[model samples]
Target: MGWISHLCLMNMKRRKTRTFLTILGVVIGVISVVTLLAVGIGVRQEMINTMIDSESICQIRVTGATGGKHKDRMILDQTVKAFQELDDVDSVYPFYELYVTLTNGKYSYDGVITGIPQSELTKKNYTKTSRRTTSNVKPVLVMGDKTASLFYNPDTDQTYDTAEKKKAESWIGKKMDLSFWDSQDSTSVRLEVGAVIDSGEDTYNRDSQSVYCDLDVLKSFLGRLPGGGTVYGQPLDANGNPYKDFVYSGAVVTVDDIDHVDAAVKKLQDMGYTTENEKEYLDTIQKYLKMIQLLLGGIGAIALVVAVIGISNTMTTSVFDRINEIGVLKVLGCDPDELQILFLTEAGIIGAAGGVAGVLLSYGFKGIVDKIAVKMFDLAKGTQIAMIPWELAAGAVVGAILLAICAGYFPARFASKLQPLDAVRNR
Candidate 1:
């Protein structure tokens, strides 16, 4: 073997501890990169899945039209009819909403009241936990759990420290007093709660301190005929009173197959309907993923830069320690190119070793992270963190080698340029 090649091998063996430390530094950096990327990807995928599962895979929301500046009834009717006639359209359900104050003795709260047709419930796939034995025009009302809980346990004091036991007791079978305001007057009604429903979504469930009753009851309570007359262009009562209109906040459209969601959304949109699907959520997630990748990569890059400095420092020290040996080799006719190559090869060896260790450490790091996540969030059961992508792992190995070579360059050049007389005499 050449003198320089033999010397590099001996140097590495002689300083085993330093070599190990350098490898450890690189390992930490690589592990950081892998773990961060994997976790970010996992979180984004999980969020998208949750959103899609809660809503239908392919759904659209349509808002009702309002008369330019004033509330025009005719425009709203025309817009609704236009959408209903679309070629790819499915069945449509309309709703009416009102905000009112409810009171039971001393406890009171303001909540939204919605009027929906029975068929709309089935179309929307709402699970009915309870219902009335008989269907009367104005007898039954369905309420969300949050609304039920409020009436079931009302607060008596300003601090809400004491429970209004009597008020809570009175709400069970009593009709709640609901007051609404008209142009300049107030009207009131009493409605009985027929049943309670539970939907898992916390945001919707909590704010849904909502009461659902039949359209007929809602019309009567609003001081309108069963079939309200067209006040603007909307169907109103015999006295020309307008029906309270509700914009479709959202709709869950079931497709023949899950795979057809994209096609169905396109078809609906082509027919002038707004759609929500995997692509919409996925695009949003991709933006966050890109940000996460940059942040994680930047952090990992800083660590790796530190490791590069360490490598440079280690090589510089090695060259100094072996100055006399380098002088002896130069004296014996070791070429400058040979000396440079030898040092570069040693740097590459260190990088390759670090890369191997780093990849192994990444796998272990991912496992630990997954375990910690499980303990912290108790997310979807049996979810496991994954390792770095193969392409990324390969890139890490190559990048490490390149960084090491760059760090070793100046030190190796310094050694090569040293005169044999100067190196030997100085030591």
Candidate 2:
């Protein structure tokens, strides 16, 4: 072997501890960066799944306007007629909702009363948790588990008859008065309780305390039709005369295909009706996730820069210590370019070692993070922590090598330019 090659091998063997320590520093920095990116991607995927899986991705909601003393103004007949005529609109169901208090003697809690048609109810998969059948006479009402638990008494371990004194044997086949103020601010009729239904969703279950009879019952109570009408079952004109153009509060439209949600929404807007898609909310969520990923990746980048400085310092020190050796090689017929190449090769070796170790360390670090997070957050153990993308890993390896070469340049040049006599005499 040539003198420079032989010298590089000897230097590596003699400074094994320093070389290993520098490699370890670089490995830790790269591993941190990879792990952070992997976790961010996993979190984003989970959020997307949560948004798209359960609800109707292809559904759209349209609400009516409420003007002055007329709150259900949006439910006008003209609006429904126009929306129903839109292309690609599969089915439309009107909705009427009210807020009222449920009372059992001294105990009471506020709940929402909604009126839905049989066709819409069936399409939404609204099922009864307690009562199997809906009774027209009894006025069946479905309750979510949370709402059911609120009225539950620990002593009796039952809902209804607990401390509340309301004698509801079961949500099914029960009679209860639903008292609410009418349009003119008078207490309306007492609607009976019906079968309790379960939506199988947390938010829907908690918020939907009770959903009463179909739209017809709601219209009768409010003195209006599916679209807003008069208490006298007649339509009111702009001049306060009897008219026939009153509409309902809102409509829930179901589309045939989920992919057509956006197209359907646009069509409705063109028809002069407001349409909303679930993706609108998901897009807002994605914007926030992207910001978080950028912030986290930026933090990891600082650690990597520090690791580069460490590599630079180590190479500079090695070059300084071997000054006399380099001068002696030059006097013994070693070319100046050979001296520079030897030092550059040493820096490259350090970079390659670090890159390999960094990849291995990332896998181990991800395992630890997964175990700790699962235990602390009560997450399913099946959750996985992945390594950085292969492309990113490859890029990091190349970047590290390039950085090392840059860091070693000045030191390698200094060693190569040393006067043979001056370097030998100084040592």
Candidate 3:
């Protein structure tokens, strides 16, 4: 071993009790910081999981223009075409919803419907569970995975798991009669079920609980079909009229990539369109998350600061015990800087070792806490309350070493300045 390292080791070993106690203090401090940091990270992640990815990051929801030059104009085909040509735009889809009554023989049910182009209903991420089969006889529509449960034999129990589920499974390729009441009259038609979407595991997995039909087919049979879900639905127009040139209330504008959402949104806003993108809201949430993490870290820092004092105290005591040795080394021409480095290195080693042990223990403690939280709380299965990222783990060890070096500075300076005559006489 190098002389400096050897001297540091000897100095620390000479006061094994004090060194061990000092290390213990550092370990407790590190455990407190690392575990709390993990908890903060975990909570922030959970919040992100709950709020983010619920909608497409690159898609924006746009309503009728109420500002700029296109004020008070209705959203229509031209608007979709205009949006599609904007910079970074991938595609734009115009859609309208309806509260309608549907029937398969005697199984009549009330539900919601969306009229969108067939091109839109066929996109991979947007929709695509079962392949669509061609049939020239009648227009086809796709049903949600759960929509089948709405139509079932009345004589049998209407439970979703029983007859409803079995009957819903048989709805693929079947014909269903649909009716919509407009402002002036009622219109009806029959539509075949082209395919059924696979069940969604989450809440917002692309129309997983609704129905969608070709816009052209729906327009032919619709006459100012009411909007909204209530019995007294919101009317789209005052007079009953055909939807050959219907105006859309809102649209979904998709950007080519997530990196282009800002540019696309700017273009839309410049055109007097108001847009809402879930990704834009994430920045606001992240601001609050940073504040929470800072608070948690501050609480843990209290313990770590206390540990720094312990290191300082141990180094100062070691200096007094080794006065004679330090004086002899100086008389033999040892540099004062070397003595300082030796003390700092010794303290740093103890701090780093303590930090490593604490990190390992923090991981074990996290596992225990997570299990207890899952069992005692209403959290979903496999939920974690504490999570230590690799960045945090590496930082803790580095921080411990730096803090120890700082704590040892004063004692190292004191030892380096001791006069050989004065130190030898005192010994």
Candidate 4:
């Protein structure tokens, strides 16, 4: 080691208790902040994963204004064509939802039905068969996994059991009677069950508890006729006027890349349409996470500030105790810069030691937290509730050392400027 470093070490060794206590203060500060920030990052990531899936991240929902002059803007085919022309848009699919009653000979179900483009539905693993039907038979429809359980056998007066639930999967190839109330008139049609789709584990799936069909088929049954004549079986409204133009409930705009989802949402909002996207939700969540981290960092800063004060006091006391020693060194031609360097090195060693120990302790603490999370919260396997990146570890150590050096700055400067004779007399 260099002579200055050796001297610095010997000085620290002379007051082992003081050095240990000061370092302990810094360690406590670092560990507290690191652990808190780690938890924040972990929770943020887990929430994003749980609440948002790939389908949600890449799609934006647009709905028309209700009870306004421009309420019909989002329902036109021209709007769909315009969305398709947007720079990042991949496709625009019409969205329709309506309450309907479904019945087999022995069972009946009442639920909402949704209509989407068959090609888009297939891409999301909605069904095993991807082929579009060409036959002129009954229109085929897909059923949600939960929609099957909504059926009750009125003849047997029973709901589906475990075994019967499994049998409901075979309903994909059967025929069913579909009926719905269009205003005051009721309409019924025979639909061929093409598939029963599992909507996965998300809390809300557009297909869950709903039947899926081609957009045109659903419109023909539930929407105003092409000639503006009748809506399903309803010939006129309560006022005896022809029905209004058919309008889609909403539109799903698929973006070519997730990075462009926010920009696309902004454009849609500018057109006065209501918009929803997971990206916007995630941005709001991230803001809250940042605030939480800032609060935690402030708490840790208090401890670190106390540690800095302790370090300053210790160095000042050392300068006074070593007045005679410093005088002797000056008499032997020691430079003022060298004297400052020696004292600063001693303080840095203390902070560096604390920082490293703090990092190790933080990791150990993280392991304990993850264990508790797994046991109590039933967090998914391999999900980390505390994440410490390498950047954080390195930053903690470097930051601690710099803080210690700064705390010792005035003390080191005072000692360096002391006159040899005055220091010897004071000692």
Candidate 5:
């Protein structure tokens, strides 16, 4: 096989110009296939990055069932403890939310106040735009940027403009009146703003009207409002006496890894809690990206198909040129299997050369595409339009070699079947 392979390579060099042209066809085909698939890879990565830029994909939102005295369905201190004990679970952040009206000078905002742990603030992308979040022990509220937009002076600016930004900038280190209500009654609490945050922009305006405070501070004022101490709409021991343990309206569970989210959600469901699995969004993204990759790969395969035709043509011509040599080899007791393998090996060598060149050039092409996107569309420097992972490159090379061998099959077979006596015929 080694001698046969060497012979095939030597024969390939005899028709240097023809071989070069055929290899060039394969190179172009490989480049098209790799670059197109790379686009799919790049775009898929972009969507995932956008989704989890400041949020963890391994998180699940858990809430208590509505209208029930069921202890199993409620999110309580015990519930948090149980969630923490789950396998692969990282930590739990339980919080209670209350409707509140915030007032800052002449501006006022109607929003929900979340009482969450200080450690979970940064994990939820609650970065301080007003001041550095040095201490979480303070009894202060962190307002969202959009919430501050409503707190800007009506006379100064009605929209979130430059003036509104300046006004929001001053919203830090100020006091606001936080008023909340229950199904039975309502109350008010005054709290100081610790900082304002940029919770990233979105069309849904999820953070447009939200504020955060420490869990202890929230519990301190919960007793002031009617039904504040209630757990899942059920009062303590049916006696109207406040429960010693604090009740969380909702909680978020963080898994050690995204793959563990499904199992964690299942366990939470079994515990009688309503859960929202963030992994569903990721699964959907994966499905869509797989479809996109297939579509792009199919489109690129058309070019490779044309290159396969070129290989078949080259192999057929080579067989015709080497008809005398084929007859001489057959007469010397060369096996037909070896003859076929020789042609196939030669075709594979051509494919290998072209695939290597194409993969290398694909990297250069990726850089060029990224630069063009940055310059033409004003995309961020970090933005990319193409990505050739090792798997994709290796797959492309293997695919090219197989396709070349397939193309050379008929020519190799024709060469192997030639009669030794017919080789010298002048007809």
Candidate 6:
């Protein structure tokens, strides 16, 4: 080791108790900063992860601009096709939701059915135990994984209990009776379940407890025939003609990337359609997180500022006590710069030691806090409410070292400028 480092070590060793006290103050400050900042980071990350996992980040929900005044201004085919052609528009799916009663044998469930374009439904979106041969007769269907679970016969716990693991194999190919109110009439339709999908890990996945079918099939069930003239008792227009065109309750436009959501929403709004994007909610959440981080960091900075003052005071006292030593060094023709460096090095060592201890203690404290948070908030096990990035850890250590050097600068300067004779005589 160099003389400056060696001398710093010796000085700290000689005044172990005093050095330890100084390091302790820094340690407390670092711990406070790391832990508080970590909490803010952790909360922000959790919220973002939730949005991503729930598949809400890139999906934009667009509805009619007329509110409830004109229900028939439903999103039409040409408009959907136009939206699909837009830049960054990966895909567009028309949504039509209706509260329906699904029945099979003695079991029945009141649920919502959402109709989406059959051609756009990707195989990766669902799992089919047995792929049914394409036939014009059966109306193909995909049911949510949770929705399939409701079909299990509670009387016999055999196949139904284990069906979830098989990806709802028992329900595949079975015809289900669906009943819903279409305007003034109560309508029913029988559809076949072609596949069952894993809607996500969350219990409240939108598809859970719901069925998905071709948009055309759903429209037909509602008495709106595709080819024309109110055959299934569809509502007539003012001209006493059946509405042949398909009308969507809403349209879900997915952007190619999350960053492009604002652009897509803006374009849709300019076209006179009301839209809602989860990114808006995410933006609000991010602002709140920034505020929280600032509040936490400010609280911790106050502690660090106090520690800096303590370090400055300790170095000043050390300079006074080492007056005779400084005089001997000056007599030996030790450079003024070297004297200043030695004192600064000593402070840096104390800060480094404290910073390392504080970081380790912060991690341990984080573990305890996470455990308490999980239990108190009923969060999933292993969920950490405080997260400390490597950048923060390294920065904290480096910051402490720099702060110490700055704090000790004036004291070191005073010691370096001391005259050999005066220092010796004063001592």
Whole-model lDDT per candidate: 0.63, 0.65, 0.74, 0.77, 0.76, 0.78
- What does candidate 4's lDDT look like per residue over 301-373, in tens digits? 7888888898899899999989999998898999999999988998898889989999999999989988898
TM-score of 4: 0.78
**What order do you get sorting by TM-score, best first?**
5, 4, 6, 2, 3, 1
- State the lDDT of candidate 6 residue by residue for 1-427, as single tens digits: 2988887888878888888889999999999999999999999998888887755689889887323334345477777888899999998878876666777765566666777766755532665544662334444677777665565455765333254454454678888787654434455567777777766555555565567777666665555433344543233456666556655667999898888999999999887788988789899999989999999999998898888888999899999989999999999989999999999998898889988999999999899989999999889999989999999999999999999889999999999999999999987
Instruction: Quote model 5's TM-score.
Output: 0.79
Best of the two (3, 5) by lDDT: 5
lDDT, candidate 1, equals: 0.63
> Clashes in model 1: which pairs?
73-232, 73-233, 74-233, 228-236, 228-237, 229-236, 229-237, 230-236
lDDT of 5 by residue, 1-427 (tens): 6888779778878889999999998988999999999989998888777666534577798998433356567678888888899999988989887766666656666657787886766544444543544343335777666665555456865544344456344667666666554444444456777776665554223444567777765565555445544532334544556456566788989898876888888988887788886568778988989998999899989989999999999999998988888888888989988898889888899889888888888888888888886798666777987889999999989999999999999999998887778864622
Model 3, 252-328: lDDT tens digits are 99887777888888888877777888768766787887898888889998999999999998889888988998888
Q: Against the true structure, candidate 4 has what lDDT?
A: 0.77
lDDT for model 6, please. 0.78
Clashes of 5: 0
RMSD of 1: 6.0
List model 1 lDDT by residue over 79-195, tens digit each.
Answer: 556545644555444456665677666656665676666664433323343335124545356666455345423343331114532212223344677765332335455767655
Candidate 3, position 282, lDDT: 67
Clashes (backbone N, CA, C under 3 Å), per candidate, total: 8, 20, 0, 0, 0, 0
lDDT of 1 at 185: 34
Arrange candidates, best lDDT first: 6, 4, 5, 3, 2, 1
Using lDDT as the yardstick, the better of models 1 and 2 is 2
* CA error at residue 285 for candidate 2, angstroms: 2.4
Candidate 2 lDDT, 1-427, residue by residue in tens: 3655576668888999988888887787777777787677667776677667755565687864544445334566556666677667677777766666655433444556666775555544444334443544333455443455455434555665444543222544444555553334444344444444455544452224555556664555455323233553333545765444545556777776666677888876765566677777777888998888788777776777787788788878997888788778889887888888888878877777787778777778878888887787677766764436677678777776777777778888888888899888868
In model 6, which regions exceed 4 Å deviation?
65-74, 98-113, 118-202, 208-214, 224-244, 375-384
Sliding window of 10 residues with minimal summed lDDT for model 1 = 159-168
| True-structure Cα RMSD, model 4 | 5.0
List candidate 5 stretches off by more than 4 Å: 1-14, 42-55, 101-110, 118-139, 146-158, 161-168, 175-191, 198-209, 225-246, 328-335, 373-385
| Runs in model 3 lying further than 4 Å from the true structure | 39-55, 65-72, 99-112, 123-199, 202-211, 223-244, 327-334, 360-390, 419-422
Could you list the CA RMSD of all candidates, in the order they appear?
6.0, 5.6, 6.1, 5.0, 4.7, 5.8
